[model samples]
Target: MPRFMGFVKMEEGIGAPPQALFDAMDKYIGEQSAQGHFLDGGGLFGTEDAVNFVVRKGETTRVDGPYAEAKEVVGGWALLQYDTLEEAIKGQEEFAELHATYWPECSMVATLRQVADEPPAPAEG
Candidate 1:
């Protein structure tokens, strides 16, 4: 089975009541799980509270909040396990529909990858 990373971009100022958003997300996850396509998922805090880091010229720079954007920004995401890329895409589409109900401009993308048996190690010292 392949794993997919789903990045969900939300419309600006489409904030839902916290409880409503949580409830909808829970229902969405439950539906996906029942369909055997849900693996794990989480919602992140607003971009203003997120930390963004970058490495350049052998130096590390940390920035508060996500990079500047002209349009929508990622509000949350999920990881899905599926038998095929198509299946993962189907799941993403479903998620998009659910998000769209609250965020008309929400956008989603799914990237499929094979899960490795072990985590990769850092470069040798």
Candidate 2:
């Protein structure tokens, strides 16, 4: 089965409702993992916890955060395995429903991306 990454992006300072959702989500993940629908997932601290880096033309330039765009930060991610993208998408909808039900006031976006089974092949020498 292929894997997909489902992520949650949110602005900081929303407060307790998201934390409550996370608590519930943790239990949900454990149950899903037992049922073989979830592989792994976790919550992340705010963007203030990040150290940003910019790589341009192969030169790496690192910067300290508090990132300027709080809205651009990703709060957490989950990895799920499924036979098809549709199954992965439908699996993540449960989390979306949790958000809508519990954290309606928080600015949040949930996204999904398919994970490649292997890294790209190197070019021939």
Cα RMSD (angstroms) for every candidate in the order listed: 4.0, 2.2
Best candidate per TM-score, number? 2
State each model's CA lDDT, in order: 0.67, 0.81
After superposing candidate 1 on the true structure, give the runs of residues whose Cα lies further than 4 Å from its correct spot: 17-24, 66-70, 102-125
lDDT of 2 by residue, 1-125 (tens): 88889998887756656577777777778888987878877778876767878999999999887877556678789888888888888888888888887677876788999998899999999
Q: Model 1, range 77-124, lDDT digits (tens) per residue?
A: 677788887877777777666655754444544334456647899899
RMSD of 1: 4.0
lDDT of 2: 0.81
Estimate the TM-score of every prediction.
0.69, 0.85
Which residue segments of model 2 deviate by more than 4 Å?
18-20, 121-125
Full-model lDDT, candidate 1: 0.67
TM-score of 1: 0.69
